[model samples]
Target chain A: MPWRRPRKKVERPIEVTRSIEESLEDAAAGEEEEDSVDLAGLDDATVVEAATGEPEPERGASDLALKLRETLAREPAPARARPRATTYPESGVDLAVDAARGLRLRNPVLTASGTFGQGIEYAELIDVARLGAIVNKGTTPNMRPGNPQYRIAETPSGILNSIGLENPGAVEVARRYGVQWAALGVPVIVNVAGYSVEDYVYVVSEMAGTPGVVAYELNVSCPNVKDGMIFGSDPSLAAELTRAVKAETDLPVIVKLTPNAPDVVAVARACEEAGADGVTAINTVLGMRIDTRRRRPILGTGSGGLSGPAIRPIAVHITYQVAQAVGIPIMGAGGVTSAEDALEFLMAGASAVQVGTATFADPLVPLKVIEGLAAYVREHGLRSIREIVGTALPRMVE
Target chain B: MIIQQGAVTASARIGDLGTVLGVSAPGIAAQARAGQFVHVRPGTSFEPLLRRPYSFNRIRRQEGEIELIVRPLGPGGEWIASRRPGDLLDLLGPLGTAFVIHRSARNLLLVAGGTGIAPMRVLAEQEASRRNVTLLMGGRSVAYLWPSDRLPPSVEYVTTTEDGSFGIGGRVTEALPELLRWADQLCACGPWPMLAAIGRMREEAERAPAAPGRAALLEAQIAVEQHMGCAMGVCRACVVVTSQGNARVCREGPVFPLGDVAFAEGEPATVGLVS
Candidate 1:
């Protein structure tokens, strides 16, 4: 008698088929699961993929009997019933927060300037409408060619960059992105960077009525260009620039502070006194990495701005100090990669958190943060995320 | 620009040149074109942070597989090169512009240096069936040259090693003149110095009344490399100066026309106001 091998288990296939039938029944019964599975509407390739482990190509291996035998031998579980998680907006949690004096956002997570481009670059990979808002690349009065080659270098737990505010100028940006911004569903925050108060005023006046632009975040903290740090480093200049921009546009003006400043809290206080709606706690720290073999700096510009997890603590500290010094809301930035990190800023007295360098590592981080914040609200039995703001601040009056 | 999770199906060590990994990514493979690259996450976490970009060495649409030549340069590259069969890779790609071969061209020349052979090899395989193809490559030594047996048999392979351990003694440029004479079009991908050398040739050709391969040199296209961040157009890193002003290597390029690119002393010219 010929030796015969035992038939492979068909348990997974049966489970997949059973799951499909269960989903169909649930849909027919008008169950509340919004993402119901409808096999009938699926394409033939998808149906084949559901039955088989992989999609069958149109050519080569199209023999019917071979496909059936292969499908049977493979453990196909394409239709497994996964635990359904509620979407962020419908999670019955209040995540609304005032990012600026007049900028009311549905959530407290925003994309940082210089990292999110014009918000259109990532629209293909993610749903931009889910974010609280998006801050576009820092725009200048005139088009900048940007820095030289080797604009980026990897540090220990961060990255150093010297991209010198490369943009198509303020007028061009507003003209090119105005219509798309209106359709993106997410509010737009224009990041204004310039060499003088006149430049800032020029950019603001040009972008005054652009669609979807809810506010202006003054980028006074760029570390890669000559005189870029002038306004951010000097409290008087920052306040002056803030007042000038607020005069030009009716939109809320939020000043972005730099960690390189001698007194970051003083800058925040000055901006607040100058009628600014809010302030971003911190921008990238100035840092450098030298190439041993080349005997020179790694970046095209010797000293570049450092960002990522390495600067998170510094940002939180600045946020805490600035919150105490000023009455306006603080938009914390620098190296916020996860929900826990965002919560750190929130508890430290920041009204909203900006996901920056981390977006380069993972594009879905902002969405994850929104979901995680909602989960936190549900877990803590809190009515709104705002209830936790400044919870970690010292209760004792100085 | 879809982020697809690819499974490793095959891995081979190509002498001392590099390690080649065959990945099954149907979505990326189907839409991939010559000169396009995939940004691969080094690991599941963000330790290495930014993703490493790798050009496709082979795109087999029928098999739903793409091949990459990964040379372990640092921790991130080592992690990617160490992946074995069944290992999953998160790839964001088929990104950037591709080399466009004019329909009139019957003779095509592809020049490569170092690991730049990734895209050059792709062009050879893609154009070999319909046209006469020649691949000219150079490396420091014989160990760095791609194995001719692995390439399409119809592709004419010529190489040079600095130490004279391979076919030709000097650099790829030493053999480029002969190939340029017989070619109607030229495409190169390599380090800054090699590309800058080609840029000089293009300048000379355009200046002279009638130089050999003048039209081809003027129309040559080259893919460049730079220290990149976000591979997406967001970060503004990896920018090179061009006749059209600043262009992002991740968005506008990784591929550019020979005459359009600006070079300064064997490197991409610095943009913005120099200190």
Candidate 2:
């Protein structure tokens, strides 16, 4: 049986480009009296035409346009002078933001904890330098062999995992990956998880001076282990754990919130009150799946953390609510697979976005998100990505 | 490992086994080994989200082609199985560790079940010229057996079906003891139950007196399978308990020493190994 479909070659409509050019010309004529043509809203093709006095290349045209626009946007010219520059920006678009107190990243795209695996695994597939930061897997005071077989199961537009905070303990993680992390170029954020406050403190202390580690993301929201969600679900316990980690090290402490918590916003506030430098709004939601054939749960742990595009909307809602309640910068995470998904968090008041389950589907997703964000910034004429943060929030009347 | 958009050169169904897809991916084919696999995307979008892992069924470097045996078990599998010539496939491969055949071993035995014949076929083609090779395959029916004509002529092909419609009846395990005495090494790939059966046999051989084939079974290396994500070794989703603790099937294996793997209750032993 031959199961082949005839290959369909997509033909780009040439009229689309002509029509865009016509509209750009009209906009340019109308703006001539304003002393400067706002080419910001123009499509990349028209931007390339206006900048280089030539048509865009069939391939890599958008990338070239972004690079050119970034360069022009950086170097300021006299009020009415024509913008001309062939150089690429030394530092690309201002995608940088204060991820945590004293923890500033070069960009706002970070690889989420657990999914990044100490940053070594994906380095073979993508350039680690392109990411804002890499959050290593959750580390505990003792080595964890993790959960049993059937650790993963696919759900609609998502996956459920019961990894159970598997790691080689804090000391071993620092010893095994410290030197490598130092040379990886990307900043490292250690995700600390444990059954007790001492476990969290011990892990923090052990990883304190490890090279390349810029901060700590307290993983109190891991739902796969016993007592893992206790701190995350309670305000006092969350504050106590945050305070313990803060006392153990001077590194910025960011608490990852659990959506299963009774009041996620209250927990965020509690962490902030306990001196947390930042907050990551929303970890995976608690979920389960049953194998119909076997008439039992699919995961070995009975239930697992649900993540992917299916949870993106829930994550955004939590981020929106938490952003309104807290002053600390929020690191939004859920099922962010695209730049548009990341943009939703940013507009809802998140300073950066962590890509988790999406990486399992496409390792290049985080890099693609970075590029897409740059395109969005250029298209909107935004001076800095920080300007877009909290834009969706209700404003107070004067 | 490189990620490439491979073009499907051919896709066809073979009896009751499933669809076989030939992909023109030079990079993957050039580096692919017997036991390693490729993670293939089902569609352009994330609806059927995760990529399915398939071992290399055939690798032709000169033609820059690699073939995969796709069993249409789910929506993702069905989509991949139905792909036609000239279709672009997103592939990340030549991943996981390959089977290691000892240089001194002159007689090699390979066991396969159902679609697990993929990696075994590669071993037969690769090691036939270097050593005396025999392959034992088992299926529920004759329709599920791999075609004997497709294999290298030098390979000794043995088959068993549950319904006795093919070669020997029952299972590969029934034919394994006799062949164990003649072989110097054993390697297998199949469902967990089959591997568990082999695991049990290995345990019995260890407890008994030293025999010609018992050493080979004890030293056997088998490629294992599990529900996987990210195949890049980051997700920690495909881990199985081993003598060395939890090991990711996508990285540390797909291939592992039979003795090192801990199987319990007909599935991978998941409890009590660690606290």
Candidate 3:
């Protein structure tokens, strides 16, 4: 049987490009940096010496400064203007971020549940191990066939889907994917969904000791199921469900909040009060589309959850609100398509961000987000990504 | 399956039928099989959020090229159909199951409706040399039909049009009976209504075990289409009800046994645990 174990950092061949910090130090020491360097604050004498390997001759310092300034102005800022990082990080930079209260992941970018499959499908085309973790399709105690044809409908910039949490059930999921998830070398956070508090406890109990599974994401806000949003919409109900699930397993429990909730911040605060480890700021917003020809709702279900770039603003807003209301880390999920979008969530106080609908268009987006995050860290010269978390949050009044 | 950028080597319009794009993707071309499809990213933008799935219209292995028949149905299709030579396309494929032919079957029959002609054309070219291949295609009008000159010389081509502007005047099912008796095996790919029509024929033939061409109808295989997302078996958006319960069209299918698939009242049956 496959069991969870500590993942060792596999040594990767380092690329020739040095970190920006190193380049900065080398520039001040009169050493030639590999390619790009920032010479913004260095004196004219130092700049001339570095460029021509000889000290500037005795002359009018102002004239020499003007000539040097003209030369510098003619050249482009190669450090900032160079090509964006398109490849994975070579070494020595930490991209780790907290996925939960104590669940530190290797990166802050993860594939949202349902969009990434069992984490094995896209493993063929891109590197799955590069992600912080993969949340499998929402799991229930029993198998579900899911909704009918027209289960998906495209909206303005997103898609409306009522997949109804189609999965092989929790027992089969742990038995089938446990080994594969362990072998894939990525953490698994099972997205648990159900109709009752007992249902949530049962799924967590069943998946308790599954290998490679680091946490449980309670999907209280799935809009496709009958009364699926009941727990998420009510704070007392959300807390009661969270407390019961927390009693069943030692794994971290993250409650996924619904934007449809009348008071999302209260629900998040209640979950945190009930021992929930973290919360996903927002689930898909309830929406629908009409077929002009048929004069009926396009989705099999009259309304489905809307996800994609269309909901990014809503997700970020909810994340910022929930971050202020609770002390638990928030996993921001919506239509996060790029590193900039992910950064929006990180600065808004989300510990990590999940990539969903965007994966449908480009399978490599999760990896690209990771690469972009590392690039962001290097360019800004930040010691770790955590320093930027909540950077944009409103400062608390003393 | 592989995800790679392929350059457009050839592009042409087939009357009012659709545009056939020839892409040079050696990796995908080498791995492609009949009935398999490629999920193509429409453009660099994200407005058209999902990749479009297109069946392989032609697979030229030695030349390291594959072709797709694309109809401009929506924004995504329009962008892909308007591609010019030397344009690069991001493709994720050769994915899903392929149509399987019994080696001993000497007479093979293929059926296509509308853009479903993509895979049928592939099979006709691949099976023509070793078997007696016959192609029966149906379209809305003469302009919507595939050019006969594009197919191999050894294959027998038949046509039908709803408007009676081309070959035998009617849907493909109308001309299907005459050839059913001669065919040892059959394969089809088309819109849901056409596939459901063939499913009906198979059901009727099953009730009469001794009927002419019963074996061919029983062994027939077909490809299906649906509103898809991800096309990587994750979203569960393109599932269809079958004998084994709900199967993803982008994964377990896009190809399945004729009898295993379920249809209701000339349309794909609604799938779920509830009624």
Candidate 4:
């Protein structure tokens, strides 16, 4: 007889088809009287994340995320998040004393002139309704294509872009974005650039009474080809341009300063003195990248502005200095990718923050930063964020 | 077109299909067109941060599988070639301007170089028996040439190889002058040099107006390629110079009338068209 193998039993992987509430019922069925031994050493935070399906809590987050979170938190997001327990007293977060002209933005996270093109591109990514206001791309009197290839360059931490104010011009932008801006449920700020004083007047005047336009950001930092006056580099010229813009349009005027300026504080002071509503700091720092293969300048213009993470330290420094010199609100921008980055600016004395290249990398950066700040605020037992403003400034040694 | 494929759709290879697009999608048989292309995303899940574009070589409608003929130039193309059939691709479209048919013209000529043959095949198939068509195909060698079986049986096929490994030892345009005299309209899509040659020849022929009714040369259109970023007209990265300044290759055209374009050299093939 042939050697016969015993009948084999096939085992299949068990399929767990737990019903909606069956798992709970099973747990209830196993109710025990004796206390269970704690063999698995898990932390409380881990338990909370597992139960809630949330990421594990992070420790030692930079105050930057908190600042961005504070401003983003002010946005009346329908779903309220329970405040976390890590927030501190106003180290740099502030929600009080903010206005962009007549527009009552809770805080000043105004998009920089060229950075925010239109509301539609970032509609899903940003809480457009919650932003203090959305700034339009730098526009001109005539529809211009702006700059050539490589207008925007990616730096280590940010991006350097010389879009040369490429835009649909004031007429087209106003017509296209006017109604959409209003629907954004936020203030619509248009960043206007001009080769001449009339160009500024004409573009602003065209939008003077438009319902959606909450204010005008005078892109005075632009290289003026007409009068050979660099509006941002020269304080007097910046002041003059600001006053001229103020006289021409009823819209609140914001003067954006160039980081390329020798003294950023004086320029901020000048814009504030010129009756401008507020100021935006540090357009991309002029820089260039070399194409190793071609052995020539990578940018067609030979130079471009650098942005991203590399510039945040500089932006915070500038904001801190400018806030000290000017009473007007300071909208700080640079390499802000997280709430922690945004907090640094606030501590430096900026009331609001603008996110630039980070949006390109992660559209959710702003929202995450906002959520992070709220968690921080609540964790620290602070009722409001104003307690943190200017907390990092060095006290006089006298 | 809605293509439901398991995963091979995202595996796109990169061949110099004449133009450059920054962000492209739909790699394998993703619903595409003859002259159309899908934007290839450079990385897995938005990491590389930019999308590349590729031409749709052929479409397998029954299987909802499309083919892309590519030569990998970057990690992205290598990435597409490595994917297995079951991989799901986040593909976009059969986008950009397609070849336009002139019902009036009875004869057609299709000139292709390298992978440019992909889109032209679609037009060739549509016009196969209905009209007279002559396909002038050129490549590096006979083996490197497109499979002749893919062409319509009605088309008179001709091939040229640079190394004399195929039918003729010269460029495709070597046979064009004689053909141009006979073919009513020339719709050539390929390298700028070849199209520019056609442009020059068309210009020379037009200067004389080809003795009255001898089948006037229909306006020639070439499907130029570029580094297109946003398939929509937003980014302005895919702009080619036109007689009317810059025009978007992705939005306004991937195909243009040969006469209207101003070709730029060096970085990549640059096309200028009359917008």
| Predicted model with the maximum DockQ | 3
Q: Kindly report the docking quality category of candidate 1.
A: acceptable
Question: What TM-score does each model's chain B reach against the true chain B?
Answer: 0.98, 0.97, 0.98, 0.81
lDDT: the better of candidates 1 and 4: 1
* All candidates in order of lDDT, best leading: 3, 2, 1, 4
Can you list each candidate's DockQ? 0.25, 0.30, 0.37, 0.06
lDDT by residue for model 3 over B1-275, one digit each (tens)? 77779999999999898999999998888888889999999898788888999999999999999999988889989999999999999998888888888899899999999999999999999999999999999999999999999999999999999999989999999999899999999999988899999999998998885866789999799999988999988999998888888888888888888888899888788775332
Flag the better candidate by TM-score, 2 or 4: 2
Candidate 1: stretches off by over 4 Å: A1-91, A222-229, A396-398
**Candidates 3 and 4: which is better by lDDT?**
3
What would the per-residue lDDT of candidate 1 be over residues A1-398, giving only the tens digit for each residue? 01112212221221111222333343233222322343345555654544432345673435643554333222111221122213233244667678889776767999999899999887766766667789999999998878776789987668999898888999999999987776565678999998888889999999988877889999887432445557888988889899999999988899999999999999899999999999998889999999999999888778899999889999999999988888899999988999899999999999999999888888778878987898898889987788999998888577
User: Which 10-residue window of candidate 4 chain B scores lowest in summed lDDT?
Assistant: B266-275
Chain A vs. true chain A, TM-score per model, equals 0.77, 0.77, 0.77, 0.73
Clashing pairs in 1: none
Positional deviation of residue A331's Cα in model 2 after best superposition, in angstroms: 0.7
Candidate 2 residue A395 Cα shift, in angstroms, is: 0.8
The DockQ-based CAPRI class assigned to model 4 is incorrect
Q: After superposition, how far is residue A210 of candidate 4 from its true place, in Å?
A: 3.0
- Tell me how candidate 4 scores on lDDT: 0.61
Which digits, one per residue and each the tens of the lDDT, describe model 2 over residues B133-153? 999999999999999998999
Name the weakest run of 10 consecutive residues (lDDT summed) in model 3 chain B: B266-275
- Give lDDT tens digits, candidate 1, residues B28-88: 8887878889999888876788889998999999999999999988988999999999999
Q: What is the DockQ of candidate 2?
A: 0.30
Off by more than 4 A, model 3: A1-87, A222-229, B273-275
